[model samples]
Target: MNINKKTQTNDEGPEDSNVHGFTSESVVVSNRVPERSTKVASYLDCSVYARACGIETMRQWFDYHRVKEGGKPRPPGIPGDPSHQYREVWKGWPQFLGTNNVASAHLSDTAMSLTDAKAWFIKNEIQTVKQFRVLCTEGLRPPTIPACPEKFYNVKYSELLAPKSGRYLGFHEARNFVHSFEFNDYLEFRAYKRNNPEMFEKIPSSPDRVYMKSSPPEWTSWPDFLGYNRITRTRLEE
Candidate 1:
């Protein structure tokens, strides 16, 4: 039989303590990779690295070494164009673009927050494109208005899917602020007590207080959200 013994230490903290004859303070960081001048690698899930290598920013190196020898450079999108090709691409662009932007915040060259990412979509005219797409999805043609200062706008897929992407707080955490309501839960609780006095202690607490102030989200009601296949909707043309 084996027994694990424990010891008492100073009041410092776990960071300052050593136990079971092991010490984290004794560890040292090292970069001693076995170096091979040119390492072979597979070309999958590494487009970003390939993209870096393909960049011809310096011009001369690209002009001399790399040419369009890799058979048409990249595969084409959907053969021929559809009216909603851009929309379809826009909806799935993130999936096609991979999770690179998701890691942009951690990259040294670029810094992006959720706010910055939202701003980028607006800056790149994606909101207008997304609104057009969503409108098309509803079989509604894009409206061409000369000028209406009060009614001009666009929508972004990211902002449309808020909460998940950090645009707005989801309702589960903000139900109390949306509205107020009255219920009969407490009445039922009282009736139960009167019917079974001996079981009063076994009765559960009334849920009336929990949803007394419950309400739906301030935004328009979400419809067919899951049915939309992850593509989102917005007030831009709803």
Candidate 2:
């Protein structure tokens, strides 16, 4: 019996080549895809998740916890009490809404104001004991919330494009909108401070300090409204 043998050849033409037909030396290149700017814009649009919670609230909560735990101490033992256990129970709560989860709801209910909530947090949670007295003298001032104009309320995309529209204001509008007295009962108190420097000074600087020191006068400006103190001053200064 004779067997037929076929010879191998390299004559595979373009049509008979791989799906993306190309010579061994001819490399096929594709253009790079552009980045999606829409997502960035959307993120920018939605950056104020916690702005509604107010700056004073944030500061007070920070101070309360900072003092209570001696500024970021390790978690307590498993059999800790309600206050200590609450810390571990919701360690990642603030990452979700950028505010203390355990305290946010409580603050909202009792204070009916984020700032007041923070104040209450400091009073009840931080300064409840005598060992935490150093926090009272830290001289950390609560940030003033900004005044969000009517433009902030208008949600039209076209309005966002406007130069002066609140949507375009970015962090300024978000931070201020949350901190302003418009969302709380302290509007009259805040306004009174703004109108009368001497009288405002007579009021305590911090709710904690009210029992300890004299208050400062209230002043209003785009800076105050946006909580644009020395730290945040540069964000919108230009």
Candidate 3:
């Protein structure tokens, strides 16, 4: 582990004849020949010995000298290479979408919305929107989102929807916007109605337009009211 930082002088002209133990100095000379080492070293001095001894030796050497320290712990084994255990644990972990399943599909959609937001922000020079999109989506673009442009508002929604834009809106953004509109509860209640119109017609609407009391009536127990059972009946009727 005897590593030396070699320094070269301008006048040295790339070659030196003066040599010492594991060290050399260069001097400017027109006919200097490259030095070759012919002496054999012990097993302890070989690179194979170093690798066989493992990266612990390197870590200890680094830690003792306070060189390039303080980051996430490097995986064990060769300093730059991952250990077998590291590979086994992260074998299927998705790098782009976090998971390799249905949730990844949803996240991919969220990424598209963020990409649009980013494009709009860059085009308008809206710093806040740009920052928000960056924070929400992380740095990398998701598969469903378009490639981010240098400037925003340069592209139109029509362009985005076009085949050339190669991007699409995701369900997560749609759900978020709908929730922001304060229509989530209504949408949830009417979800079944959308699938079965006849059964939806059978379930009676609230007698009072607004339930202002401290405790609202339990619609599930009311026979004519729309509830889980009514929704199920609609599905069955279908």
TM-score of each: 0.19, 0.16, 0.16
Q: Which tens-of-lDDT digit does each residue in 1-238 have in candidate 1?
A: 1112233355332352232333322211121111222332212211222232232221222232333643222112211112223332232211222333223233323334434444443443433444544443343431221011111234334342212123222434322211221112334445755776564433223222222212322332222111121244321221
Q: What TM-score would you give candidate 2 relative to the actual structure?
A: 0.16
Model 2 C-alpha lDDT per residue in residues 1-238, reported as the tens digit of each score: 1111222256433342222222212211111111223222121111121122222333343443364666432122211122233333332223322444434434323332333423333344332232222333343322221111112222222211112222122333333543443322245545655777563443422222232111121234434443445453343432
The lDDT per prediction is 0.28, 0.29, 0.30
- Candidates ranked by TM-score: 1, 3, 2
Better of 2 and 3 by lDDT: 3
Superposition error at 107 for model 1 (Å): 2.4
Question: Over the stretch 76-129, how does candidate 3's per-residue lDDT look in tens digits?
Answer: 221331211233322211321122332443544444453454344344333343
RMSD of 2: 24.7
At residue 27, candidate 2 shows an lDDT of 16
* TM-score of decoy 3: 0.16
Question: Candidate 1: misplaced stretches above 4 Å?
Answer: 1-110, 128-157, 160-238
The alpha-carbon deviation from the true structure for residue 118 of candidate 1, after best TM-score superposition, in angstroms, is: 1.5
Using TM-score as the measure, name the better of candidate 2 and candidate 3: 3
On a 0 to 100 scale, what is the lDDT of residue 109 in model 1?
A: 34
Q: Which residue window of length 10 is worst by lDDT in model 2?
A: 143-152
